[model samples]
Target: MTELSRRELVTFLASLGIALPLGRAAFAQGTGGGGDPAPGAVAADAAAGTLIRFKEPVPYSFERLVEETREAAAKPYDPVDVRFADTLERIDFDQHNRIKYRADETLDLNDGKAPIRFFYLGRYFKLPVGINVVDGDTSRQLIFDPKLFQIPADSPATELPDDIGFAGFRILEPNSERDWIAFLGAAYFRTSGELDQFGLSARALAIDVAMPTPEEFPRFTDFYVGPSAVGGRVKIACRMDSPRIAGVLEMDVKKDGPIVMEIRSRYFAREAIGRVGIAPLTSMFWYSETDRGRRVDWRPEVHDSDGLAVVTETGERLWRPLNNPANVMTSTFGTGSPRGFGLLQRDRNFSNYEDDGVFYEKRASVWIEPKGGWPKGSVQLVEIPTDDEIHDNIVCYFLSEKPVAKGDAIAYDYRLTWAKDQPDRGRVGEVVATRIGRGGIPGQPRPPGVVKFAVDFDGGMVASLPRDAEGVEAVASASRGELGKVDAYSVKVDTAWRVTFDLKATGPEPVELRLYLKRGDETLTETWSYQFLPLAQTG
Candidate 1:
């Protein structure tokens, strides 16, 4: 089998309505070109078999699943064998859409709070997953039934057998008109966020992503859904396997205002996996205001997430503005059991995006909160280049300090909140905006290769301070460049403070810049860090 790059996997998943999380540059090697199989007409298989049945109410528990997955990981990986995969692989987007799950067949789980609908096997989603329902202490596997799908007569999906199973499934809203959460395409899953628009995605695991070695994509082969003992909560269990690791995941999901999920993951490595990423988030940042000249898109801004926010263990908050760099870039922040981190869509106004169709402004911001004392690790942010919004170019996750050897076991407990904003500790001010332009005097022959940046900070104690407050200073530094013409002042509009500066390039490499507002001995805002790619975007 030819190893697939992360971009190729994303391209295939995006075709199936599951946008791949993360981005890649325009000039960089991409897998989004043509040659995907076209949609074909219905070709029913005469030898279709009946749906397979497992004993109902079989004894089951979260612990049992973890144990079983551990034993499975000790053995060699076994890839799925899809029957009539060639025909299924031809189910294009339109054809896949036509093969919808009938409303009458929606599973009535959890006292009918949300109906469960199965996704059909298609070209991009060829792996069939086993699904089950749990009641009390027992669980029963759900059999695949072609009759559950209303396939168009012209679609080739009818050719698949009744026992071919499902690609993944979704949880329909109370009205049954739309789905709020979906798990499809490998280990990828996402919620509609607090705004009910699906933009980015969160994965179960990430292995060696953007590394020299080809990335490993683990898949959830089975799912068990049940009513949680906790009030108004649902329990979901997953059995995931891959060439590198086998694991079990359990989530106590609640459709609160923020769609909170308490996730517990157990992993047993099948091999000596390097660089395991936990609680991975994937998003897209095409051309925002900071790099307006990068793309010719009509929108003023285009991005699902604009920055990666982190709260260190010592109560210090840091904000790193995301970018669509010319080349792939990875930033790691070493921390000892950090409070939390997330990729956030802080700009909430529709005017910022001017995209009414997709409503990018309403995209949700996801945050991860560790349940206990997390081991020493680093919050890693990987930014890839992309010319279009269709490609997800930003990925943020936690990398463990310790390496995992073959047969080693790892466990994590965390909470995922899909909210409009991250939890505000109200410790200091926040960066509201970041803008860049040609660095030079207004009309004095725009200097070559100089970039100007303006960062806006608002809220917290600084906004409440009098405009004439003295001793307010902008402390800034660059890792590999010369900082010039630095100025900081309080802007009357919105009672925000703005810092303007010019960066004189010292080399061709990208520069890491950090700045924070302070008044005498007291810091007034969280550190604002940005990656300045001199050669990537220019006025």
Candidate 2:
């Protein structure tokens, strides 16, 4: 992750997390994986030929196709090729996510609406996903048909090949008129953000990620998309392989309010991997809850997620507030086949953010549910302290045995729940606000202290007590400082309580602190954890 625009950063400095523009490789590849729309064959798939016509039963079977491709890719990267029909040849991005396959043209005509639309190929996306519609053995496969799409007469759109196949497809609501999910870009795909507008993305597999060395990103080379009539769901099965890994994917995308995708993937490592990330979510967490008065803009926060929540395999729920560090920060929590983890937006107040456009507070919280029992590993959260929001800053995933190794078979399945509220297992004492300033008391002589902290926590049993309640105690500790007087009492507004404390930072290194309210024998709320960066250099 790199730096972001000063404008976006100033507003989102509290929850800072970032990633650079999808380098060309992160976008897609031409081989067997689901990558961007293959660009070179832009103008034409062939010099000239009869438009591919579907007669009756298409001969292709997605299941058999995947089994064969996986076996072939198991050897080495010889570059699996697709002999595409002319109609499925050259399309662009605008044309990709927008080209709606008409109701009459719906391939699987079993039920309601088969959400079918294609992704066009272009600069950020180049690898073409081999798409073929099946009707038993008589598969009326696809060809890049420019007529199916009506592009706004623009610069990039006008320059594309007339017969380019669609880059990928987004599934529309089977009953409603809107879209529910999409499989586009690189091995990248997503449902809409908090407001039903698409932002940020999730990758099927990540290799050598966040390393100083150049990373390897595998693309989804082909797709076996179908309709699941048995369970009232849409099924999308993907065949994935790269220079480093190979696998299969079966995703059942369903919709309630926010669409949910239950994904199961089988991964095979072709070589030793330094970092293997499972259910990796790439997002921007600029600022939220912590850094406020120092903002460079009017908005209080700008971020896609505000915290990291992990449900260990034993069901112990832990919430770590997201941070915007001055440098790249990576923490690997050593654990077993973790139950689940994800980037989340816990606060859902509009006034807390005060921004009308790009609702930072309303952003969705994505929860990754493990497919099965995973082996011992770590749930890694990489936070790159940055100044802007354009660059993605938050990456949460599972780092497996040595990242990767030759002849390693890694399989995982998880449910992705996209919603506005976080998935907190208990009455966790959630962290509300964290304010930092000079340590001196108001109107008193300023001391030698450089920094002070005021952390506010609400929710749980902490609010039901009286102003003089003594049964509840505030347990506070710091890694490198003398902790000061800690006090707790019920707040006047909303049945919430306020816990205030001060810390005298004693060293140059950051101070790690954890605090929670407990009434003697019982815990009142979820523990609030924080990592405070040391103050700036003074004269």
Q: Which candidate should be chosen as best, given TM-score against the real structure?
A: 1
How does model 1 score by TM-score?
0.90
Query: C-alpha displacement of 270 in model 2, angstroms?
Result: 0.7
For residues 1-539, write the lDDT of model 2, one tens digit per residue. 11112333222212222222322212111111222233332222333543344434445654565567567656887664543322223433223323333333334333655646565664334557767554444344566665444343433445556655566776555554455456655576766643564444677876666699866667787776665544666667777778877877777766567657878787777777788888888777767657664466677777778778777766555667787877777877665778778887777788877866555665678888776677788888888766666666777788775546687777777888787655445565666666666665789876676456666666655555665677877777777877765777676676667667767776667677777778877877666667777642221
Which ranges of candidate 2 are over 4 A from the true structure? 1-66, 79-110, 132-140, 152-163, 174-177, 193-195, 401-403, 460-469, 506-508, 535-539
User: CA lDDT of 111 in candidate 1?
Assistant: 81
In the range 68-176, model 1's lDDT, one tens digit per residue, is: 9988988998887777878986786545645656554567778888677777887777888989999888999887777656566677876777677788888877654
How many steric clashes between backbone atoms does each model show?
A: 8, 58
Lowest-lDDT window of 10 residues in candidate 2? 24-33
Model 1 pairs in collision: 22-392, 22-393, 23-392, 23-393, 24-385, 25-385, 42-154, 42-155
